[model samples]
Target: MKPELLAALNAERAARRACVVVTRLADGSQRLVREDELVREPMARDTLAAPLAEALRTGRSAAIEHEGEKLFLNVHAPPVKLVATGAVHISQAMQPMARELGLDMVVIDPRGAFATPERFPSVTLLAEWPDEALARMPLDRYTAFVALTHDPKIDDPALHAALRSACFYVGALGSRKTHAKRRERLAASGFAEADIDRIRAPIGLNIGAVSPAEIALSILGEIVAALRAERVAAKAALVP
Candidate 1:
């Protein structure tokens, strides 16, 4: 309700941070906990301190008692990180697909010709070799790596990098024979057979695609399937 507190809240929101507001209750208890980190308490300030402290510590919004009034607080969290590797023709098609799926996509390629905005207008383009480029790119739980380059020199290093990171999906574009060779190469490079299996090589579903665009569609479809499968597995793990 105070102008200074309101300004502070606005500033935090502008910085993209979650905040919780706390309000006190009349019975020296906390009353309302709102999603936007705003809490209202009718209790005294001192009575509200403990609940507010707990909410802040747990990064949650809670109601607390302040002089017997209830107050509420809001909490903010960072957005998810999403990045895509390999900026080939398939990538041009895949970028829009990813955007449609609400992913923050980025394109990485060593060839300037392939990594231009003209080719990938909706994605962040990084024209560096995957080994060097992925070194700087942030890969996390929500990140997905797709290797469409089809060249072992490019795809192998990128695949290796993706496997080493916490990325949720890692795939390589190739046919069955090509994927066999890829697995051999990775094994030769000291990766375990199990690690090599992490790649969804022959990358897409067996959808009988002949064109680049159709292939991209199949690949993205597989990615979505993999994501859904992971979600389902996670839920199953929590069911018990």
Candidate 2:
């Protein structure tokens, strides 16, 4: 890697932005493709465009033959993170599963009674309001935000932040009726219909989950689905 290219790639990684280093094996030529530059960059607009986009989206490196020459694509995607609004029972159950899935988990709740260290010993527990805690964390495109607390005061602010940012998944725990009310509140607070639609209310896949553990499983399943949905679709498109 060239010094300047290495510096630029390091900068992107520090910013937690998705980037790819493409190397042409035949002649040892190399170039960097950044997510923000994918659309406008000339070099990325040819046959390499699709693979570069896929590498950024799926965070998978690949060696492929392009124009009779071998090219290697090294993907540098930010690690996926799970940020929950409340340290409730469901959040407790989610801790283990999130870790097992390799997701960096964070629980934020202001209630002293629930946000105890004993309750979340293995997780990054922030015993503070979601807005304040989230402000310190980088809520980027690789993040999955969940508002598990039913309280609007707690969940709404986090939802607003997630919607305003580029979180990959934004979910909330509530019934349809409860979500309806929440939608009304968000709309009244100046959120567009499309922005509100991004939130997966009545969160988790519909598997008739009853217990906290079961609900946590369902939510994690849904999060995984959201994370891979685009890649899955892209694969299906190539099946023909």
RMSD of each: 8.0, 3.1
lDDT of 2 by residue, 92-201 (tens): 99998999898989999999999999999878999999889888985888999999989999999999999999999999999999999999999999999999999997
lDDT of each: 0.69, 0.91
How many clashing pairs in candidate 2?
A: 0
Q: After superposition, how far is residue 29 of candidate 1 from its true place, in Å?
A: 11
Error of 1 at 61 (Å): 13
Best by lDDT: 2
Best by the TM-score measure: 2
Deviation in angstroms for 204 in model 2?
A: 0.5
Cα lDDT, model 1, residue 74: 52
TM-score of 2: 0.84
